[model samples]
Structures are given as C-alpha cells and as structure tokens.
Target: MVDTVSEGGAPRRGRFIVLEGLDASGKSTQVDRLAAWLETRGSHVHVTAEPTSGPIGSLIRQSFAGRVPLDDRVIAALFVADRIDHLTNARDGVLGFLERGIDVVSDRYVLSSLAYQSGDVGMEWVLHANEVATRLLRPDLTIYLDLPPAAALRRLETRRGIPDRFEELERLTRAYADYELAIEMLHEKDSIVRIAATGTPDEVAERVRAAVAGEL
Candidate 1:
C-alpha cells in the first residue's frame, strides 16, 4: 500500500525505504550503500534525508547546531512542518520521485522525530503532534541500525570535532528506548527490520540488504 498504488489508474509507485538510527550509527553511509545495491538490482533510486535543505528544515538544523536556541516543543513542531514539505513539495519532494516509479531511500523520517522528540517531551505530546498515521507518509520499510548508545557516542567523538545538542549519552539512551517502543507499536503497519549495528559499515550494509530483499 505504501510503496505501491493500484487505484484510479495511477502509475505503479516505487518503494519508500527509510534507514533509522541514533547519531553516528552509520545511517548516512548505509543510505548510500543501500541505494547503490538497489540500483545494481535495476531499481532507479533517489536518496534523501530529513531536516531537509528547505527553509523550515534549515531552521531545524540551526537549532541542532546550537546556532538557534529553541525549546524542545518548538523543535518538535518544526519537524512536522519540515516533514510535510519534504513529502509534498513539487521540486524534488519524496512523493514526486515515488510517483514517478523511482525508489526513495531516506536517512531518517517520522520515526526519528517520534523517538528524539518524545525523549524531550512525552510520547503522548509527540504522538498528538505528528498524527503520523494520517498526516505523514509512513515508510514502506524502515531498517533500524541497532547500536548501543555508548558506542554511538564513541563514534561521534572521533568523527565530528563538536557534538550537537542531542548527542548526549542520556538523550541517546532515551532515544533508543523510544525507538524500541515505536518499532513495536508500528511493526504491523510499517514493516520494520532491526539489524545489529555493531561492526564494519560493509557488514551492516549486508544485513540491510538482506532485510530489504525480503520486502522487495
């Protein structure tokens, strides 16, 4: 239903696959690898990420970088606006690509907001804010790169000279717990696959490939 449409004589849409993980869990790297694999298998691919380069998304990044101080609730609200734009904008929006039969692989989607925002505000508030089932386009498949918070922190220190506001150990731990809850709650509707993220980037990509093969 999500990755395909069979109604109103519309063209067959491509799959919307999402890669989710805490900071430094190799999400960006895997997004590339997964897209490459899908292309090798002959599926046209479009890769994107949340906190897009759009106006609203730019504001969100400013907040993440500590350049713009904002309340947690405010940031949560920005995500909703950013996400809506990410999907519907005619210029390179996700729906535009998918509607044209090009597969879309995103680095993060609604699940990231659900997990990270809920860590700051309660889950009830985030759920009420997003209304994901109705407002956002749920991913056809979400592959979670499961890594311990401490390990992710280690990577952050070495990979980036300065950590962002959401890079704390406590926040990362809470986000992981939130991910578990979100996965359990949406498994039936979202078709999520959890792969252990401890290993080389190529190792994790292999697992991601296996999980995606099942859905394709």
Candidate 2:
C-alpha cells in the first residue's frame, strides 16, 4: 500500500522534495549533490529554489537587495505570488519536469515563508496566508538541515559572495529557533526529516542522500 499521508489532496504524480534551513545551512550543496546522484542513477531530477527566476522571482531577489522595500505582509504575499508563477508558468519548467517523472528538488519552499513571516508578523497569520498561497502545492519529502546558529554564522562569514539583507542580521539566532520550531511542527505531522548539518558539505550531502534513499 502507498503512503497516503502526504499533502496536496491524496497526492498527485511526481515527488516534490524540499530542503529547508537558515541562510547558511548548506542546503544548496546537499541539494546539488542529491540531484546529481539521482540523475546518475537514471532518475530524471530537476533542482530549483524559491524566490525563483521568474518575473516575480526577479522582483523578490531585487527586494532582498534593498531596491524594493515592501512591507512584511506584502513580502509574504509576493512570495506566494512568485510561487504561483514558479509552479505554473510553462517557461519556469518545474511542472514540465515533474510531468515527465523528474523528481523536483527545491532549496526552500513554504517553510521559508513560515520562518521569515512568522518572525516578522506572526505564525498564525503566516500559516493562514500560506494555506491560501500554497493551496495544494506541498512537498512529498522535506529534508531540514538542522544546524547550530553559531555554526551557520561562521559559514556565512567564510562564504565568498555578497550577503543578502537578511544575512547581515543578528536575527539568525531567532531564525534558527524558528526553523527548529517549524521542524517540530512538521515532525508532529510526520512530514519532515532533520539532517544534522554540522560537518563538511560532503558529509551533510551523504546524510541527506541516505535520508531520501531510505524514503524511496
């Protein structure tokens, strides 16, 4: 018998995989590794992220650069709007890949909205808004990178790139706490798996691969 516990109305075709965490939790490394491995094994895998590359996604990215100072509520709504475009726009290619039996992996998803909006607005409001935004688009497997706030900060300091607006804040401690709380909420619903992200990128990637492989 198939597991009918996933969201999105008794589950449609395609497996939706999500990697969630704080800014420097090494989610990108793990996601890339997992996608490569899946492709190597003959699985059609497509890897992407939230704040995607669509028109709305471009605006969201610009907003992060301080070019667009939308209110917290507006930011949340914009994320949902961008997600709609990401999921539906034929040019975006996520739905197309999924339709072709390619597993869709994402760097962040609704969880990011929950953490950021909840930190700024409130958890209840974030949840309510997301329920409307995400309607039936939910992940089948959500791998959460569980890392200490201090470690995440260290990685951010050493990484070679321009930091976004959120990266320069002391809010990471609260963000880490919020992610942990969100993980707990997902765990209670049996929809999330926490991978310890306290080691090298390869180590974390292996752990994530193992987690996904076990589920498969």
The most accurate candidate by TM-score is: 1
Q: What C-alpha lDDT does candidate 2 achieve relative to the native structure? A: 0.78
Please give, for residues 1-216, the per-residue lDDT of candidate 2 as tens digits: 233233755334567899999888988888899888877776667889989978888888888877878787777788878877778777755666666556899999888877776788877777777675456576878998987778778878997866776774467777777777777666654478888988888889899889988876
What is each predicted model's overall lDDT from 0 to 1? 0.87, 0.78
Candidate 2 error regions (>4 Å): 1-12, 188-190
Estimate, for each residue in 119-210, the C-alpha lDDT of model 1 and write its tens digit: 78887787777785335477889999999999998888887455678788998999999999988877877888999999999899999999
TM-score of each: 0.92, 0.87
Q: Candidate 1 at 22: error in angstroms?
A: 0.6
Q: What is the C-alpha RMSD of each candidate to the true structure, in Å?
A: 3.0, 4.5
- Candidate 1 displacement at residue 86 in angstroms: 0.2
Q: Candidate 1 has which clashing residue pairs, if any? A: none
**Maximum-lDDT candidate:** 1
